[model samples]
Target: MMFEENPPSSYLTRAAHSEDSQETITAVSHVLQDQENTRPVPADNSKSFAASGDLPAKPISPQQRLARLRLLMSRQKAEYESKIASLEQRHRELQWEIRDTHWQLGQQRQRHRLAEMRIRDAERAKEDAERRNEMLQKEMEEFFETFGEINRWK
Candidate 1:
């Protein structure tokens, strides 16, 4: 519709730098829509709005269009910043969760090491107990043999 009203030269000059992305297309559409929404100077070339709309037109010159676009851009920028702040907060929360998980893993490793040491010490103690029992059995057998031989001689 804009191409139909405005000459190819006017629109093409502005659109020359735009690419095919949807966002870029949408932004261009918004500018085109904004420019078209203004009242065309009354065919008689008078500056008054009495001929058509109840309110005076918003953009009459290149400067006016620039100002209007600046205002729109500023508003969009503020919205983007607010959304970014929320994302940044989420990022920080994720980082904290990562730290907590790492700490828990460290604690698990320490507990595992302690359990291994206790098991090793228990095995050594068990070996020592077995050796002491074997020695006691040998000494008791020797005492019984000696006492039995003495009783027999008497």
Candidate 2:
């Protein structure tokens, strides 16, 4: 588990500011541009094999090659489907995790709100107590003054 003190934007800024990363990005862009300029050569039956001066050996008939291509394509399609299914499963898991995190955050917010309310109530109670104490002190002072006058008259 990793504890992150800073927010996501800071990490993004750090990544964007790296000089080595910029050079790497430029290199990758150039490589991709070169790839865009390159084209695949079509299969030519008349082309001579590079290793041998003779024509390229035809391993299978046209029909057999077509069947092979179909099989390969189907295999690739199935592989892609499996990959997609796994990716979808992972996406669902991530979504559930996000939902759970949001729920936890909501619960925390509710708890914090409740705590704030309790604190406010406590503060009000403290004020009321202080006011009551002051009133009692004033009453005690008045009682003492009345008792002193009565004693003086006696």
The best candidate by TM-score is: 2
TM-score of model number 1: 0.53
lDDT of 1 at 88: 100
Instruction: Return the lDDT, model 2, position 139.
Output: 97
Residue-level lDDT of model 2, residues 1-154, one tens digit each, is 0222332224334545777765534433443334334535447634535643453354444354335435645665687789899999999999999999999999999999999999999999999999999999999999999999999999
Best by lDDT: 1
| Candidate 2 clashes between residue pairs 3 or more apart in a chain or in different chains | none
lDDT (Cα) of model 2: 0.64
Instruction: Please give the distance, in angstroms, between residue 114's alpha carbon in candidate 2 and its true position after superposition.
Output: 1.8
**What are the per-residue Cα lDDT tens digits for candidate 1 across 1-154?**
2233443334444555666555444444556565567647556535565545466456455455446656755665686788899999999999999999999999999999999999999999999999999999999999999999999999
Q: Output the lDDT of residue 147, model 2.
A: 94
CA lDDT of every candidate: 0.69, 0.64
CA lDDT of 84 in candidate 1?
A: 95
